[model samples]
Target: MAATGLTPSKAGPSRPSAPREAAPAPPGGAFARALRRNLTAHAFLIGAVLCFAVFSWYPMVREFFLAFQTTENGEVSWVGLDNLATVFNDPAFWQAWRNTLLFTVLALLLGFAVPFLVAIVINEFHHAQGYLRLLVYLPVMLPPVASVLLFQYLYDPGYGLLNELLRLLHLPEQQWLQDPDLSMLSIVVASTWMNMGGATLIYLAALQGIPGELYEAAELDGAGLLRKIWHVTIPQTRLVLSLMLLMQVIATMQVFVEPFLLTGGAGPEGSTTTVVYLIYQYAFNFNDYGAAAALGLLLLVLLAGFSAAYVRLSRAQDE
Candidate 1:
């Protein structure tokens, strides 16, 4: 080997002087890395992807498309905003929206309050906590059809347990299901029994996570139970409460089964025709898929707005 002034042995042309620094990865490269990691980390993602693709993405896309088109003799033709305009012009839309809101408000008033109160009290009670939790969740485990059918007897206008109880107490028997005014209210009550159980258990579980020291500190500060609840309990459980409120906004918007089974799909004089029920009537009763899809899209938008607002508020609080 001839070595003079450290001449390099030419296995190849001396490598070009290296760049001073390496180029940074493109923005999308990070995403690709994350995708690979997540895919390699879990096998469940494949099944989840397939399920979401088939059920959620496919239906949502088709529904949006269907909203703009009507099927005639197995051919689809665009009707533009006609479906939406028709839905808006229909008197039933407003009626259904009103009924849906009323049901949600009534449910929030009775359903949210009673369950929260019960959960807090139950959580505080020392004895048989597990047993009490199980008891409260029993209604949630019951079959929906069974629950609705049982309420049918309870809501019977005549010769029902509710009316008999009223009579025993010298109270006039009011029309529970047959009267327009009371029909929604009756369904709300029956549904509250089913709904409250799940929410109450959720509250109970949330309450368990809250530090007992907070309550103890509040107690030391001469805080009464209500004051402590206002200062400590409510604040501590605020997230859970907001989550439940959002859930109620979503679930109550889609009120169907109770009204469907109890009030014969429409309440007395069409009082309980919720937006979802209206969709059902349009799709199944009149075979108006376009109108149904339009109405459904509108409902989805409204619910999404509510959810977004709640999420923003919640994030602000966390910050």
Candidate 2:
């Protein structure tokens, strides 16, 4: 028998394998990821800042400097308060203010009230709401110049649709844009027609947001339409109304286009001459940029003060 050399050897302990090391991260990887994530937002912000700097901030700074400086033949010199003094002393200054105030009042009466009323009326109708909204907003979509021109034709004393309607109804045909007494009113009417669409839509949105349960509760309380509106609707939309009122006042005070196109920047007997029109006159017609800037500074100050006060009051009310 062959003895097999198969003696079992004593087994030694096996060595453990070495642990693998992770790959190192790329340099600045976190920073690159963050930059890429916000790149679009940063781009939009930068563009907005640049636009404001160029068109708003730069112009404002230039206007402030120009207000205190005068230009003569090509040379510029500081004039302290002379430009402001000149603006104050101008004969047309008070008249322009008076006209602007009047326009503001008239615009508020028509522009503010009409849109709210229109919104209310439209909101009451459940059917054809889209059609009504589109019809109301059509004028807003039109070019401002075209709308003004259309109104201009409608205001012509002869051969105008409005006057023709008056004739048909045996009413006196009015000189809508020619007569001093009626010129401002006519302008207000046209402005209301052209601009009320936006306000109406805003009011409509606010109205729609009001809870239907409130109206139902009012109805249960034996409230009529007017009572329901006064109690439920008005209270619900008060904030919107306040905001729109402030905006309306600011916008009306700065009105230029309506009066400008309607009455050639000044109505009969300078009736429709607004502060903005006066500013235009100073800068362009009379070539008095200093006075224009001074006047603009005054307006800016006034509007800023008014806005600040309004915001403070609103905050107080909220509190």
Indicate which candidate wins on TM-score.
Answer: 2
lDDT of 2 by residue, 1-319 (tens): 8556644454466679898898886567888878778999989999999999999999999999999999999999999999999999998889898998898899999999999999999999999889999999999999999999899889989999899999999999999999999999999999999999999999999999998999999999999999998999898999999999899989998999999998998889999999999999999999999999999999999889998999899989989
Q: For candidate 2, what is the TM-score?
A: 0.90
Note the residue pairs that clash in candidate 1: none
Residue-level error in angstroms, candidate 2, position 88: 0.4
Give TM-scores for every candidate, taking all chains together and pairing residue i with residue i: 0.86, 0.90
Q: How big is the positional error of residue 260 in model 1, measured in Å on the Cα after superposition?
A: 0.5
Worst ten in a row by lDDT for model 2: 2-11
Q: Tens digits of per-residue lDDT for model 1 on 1-319?
A: 6555544553558768867887776567877778867876556878889999999999999999999999989999999999999999999889999999999999988888999999989988988998998888898899999988788888776878899899999999989988998999999999999878889988998999999899889888999989988998899899899889899879988999999989887778999899999999899999999999999999989988989988998899799
Best by lDDT: 2
Deviating ranges (above 4 Å) for candidate 1:
1-42
Per-candidate clash tally: 0, 0
RMSD of each: 9.0, 6.1
